[model samples]
Target chain A: MITIELNGQQQPLPTGSTVSDLLSTIGSDGKSVAVLVNQQIIRPENRPTLMLQEGDQVELLIFAGGG
Target chain B: MDLLQLGSHSFSSRLILGTGKFSNAAVMLQAVRASGAQLVTVALRRFNREQAEDDLFGPLSTIEGVTLMPNTSGASTAAEAVRAAHISRELSGSAFIKVEIHPNPQHLMPDPIETFEAARILAKEGFLVMPYITADPVLAKRLEEVGCAAVMPLGSAIGSGQGLANAAMIELIIRESSIPVIVDAGLRSPSEAAHAMEMGCGAVLVNSAVAVAGNPPEMAEAFAEAVAAGRKAFRAGLMQKSGSAIATSPLTAFLGATL
Candidate 1:
């Protein structure tokens, strides 16, 4: 198992985990979430192919009401 | 009136709505419909799995004719704002971005340098960048030169309801800017929206004025009408102001005198 930071929280995941796997593990739809791995944005189409490295930082963003 | 054009997109309504501070999604939807706003602004924040079900994307999707404009609020630096803009595009599927960089929490005044930097970056990235700025004509022109789609100058501080405290400066910005000038923030009522439109602004974006009203939908309708009236008035050409009142009838040749 390897540790990665998800939304500033550390989590353990199996080796060779892709961003898609992370979404499945977290039960996120991946449709409404914008994922950033190590401050680099992962486009929705590219998420499946991109693998998450150990100690990688990830942030998920969503729409909120604002003026 | 002609359509409101920003970048490659054209919208029918001149009033842009901000989707914030509403009590709920239902009211926000009603307000958007009643306001006749073709574009609306939203913010991006950390997504929580537990709150995913109640996320705003679903209800906002239901409102027809409204395109989402994601704002990079709470970002103090250009890089942060750019990152937020990219994330916003991914989430909303829209290239429209509102570059809002307010480092100071208390004042919430947009940082001009950061905003300009972000605008340049976002514009180069092929995003339709609309920066929120102070009523500075020089900066407005600078932003336009950077290929920004529009310039949104604050009428006053955000949510202050002060109603165009910098009207003269804003007028200058509108006159100097090549792109659309959208008067945003600090508008207290429909009359203020009308006033902004009357000043030849391409559009007016209001949030607290409508969302915090006693009845949001009703207020939205009022704003829509006011904006339309203002645009019509502007197009028709308002009579110039004069120091002395002029008589409707001729002074030398009155009704009986002419006869």
Candidate 2:
């Protein structure tokens, strides 16, 4: 298992978990969410190819109400 | 048609709606529809499974003619805002980004320096940057010079509903700015929106005024009408004010005994 930071919180994932796998584990279908790894956007097509390693900084953002 | 032109995009409604402070998504959507706002503002928040309903992109997308203008509200610095803009562009596929960098939440006053930096960079990156700033004419002009799509000066503090406390400065901005001057905050009623438009603002953004009203949808409709009326009134030309009253009828001898 490898530990990665998800939205500022530590989360444990299996070894070599891809971005898609992480989203699936979190019960998100990867819709309407922006995934960033190390401050770089991981596009939808690349989510399956991008592998998560230990200490990877991951952030998933969605649009919320604002003025 | 008299469209509010921002960058290369045109919008029929001058009343830009904010998606915050609503009781729920349903009512928010109702207000969005009733407001007829083609451009709406939203923020980037961390996705939590427990609060999946907080995500507004899907629901707002369903509303036709609604374009997302994601704001960099949570960012305290230029770097953070720039990063958020990039991510938001990736998500929304829209070039519009509202550069709102208020470091201290107490007053919610945008940091002019950071906002200008973010707007300059974002505009150069080919994004239509609409910067929310204080009602400072100098700053507004500077942002315009940096290629911003529009300058959104606060009517007062964010969410305060003070109703154009900074009207004087805002008017100065409108007079000097070549780009759209949008009053983006602190509006309480439809009249205030109309007043802003009458004062020559290109657009007005409202959130708390509609979201907290007794009937949000009705209030939204009222604001939309007021904005249109004010814009029309402005286009038709407003009469100048005078210190003394001027007689409408010929003060001629019609009422007098002598011709």
Q: Note the Cα lDDT for every prediction shown.
A: 0.90, 0.94
Per-residue alpha-carbon lDDT of candidate 1 for residues B106-199, written as tens digits (9 for 90 to 100) = 9899999999999999999999999999999999999999899999999999999999898999999988877899999999999999999999
Worst 10 residues of 1 chain B by lDDT: B249-258
Q: State the number of backbone clashes in model 1.
A: 0
Clashing pairs in 2: none
- Interface RMSD, prediction 2: 0.6
Stretches of candidate 1 above 4 Å error?
A14-16, B249-259
| Top TM-score hit | 2
- Each candidate structure's TM-score, on Cα atoms with residue i matched to residue i, is 0.93, 0.97
Chain B TM (all candidates): 0.95, 0.97
- For model 2, how does the per-residue alpha-carbon lDDT over B1-259 read when each residue is reduced to its tens digit? 9999998899989999999999999999999999999999999999998999999999999999999999999999999999999999998999999999999979999999999999999999999999999999999999999999999999988889899999999999999989999999999999999999999999999999999999999999999999999999989999999999999877767656754
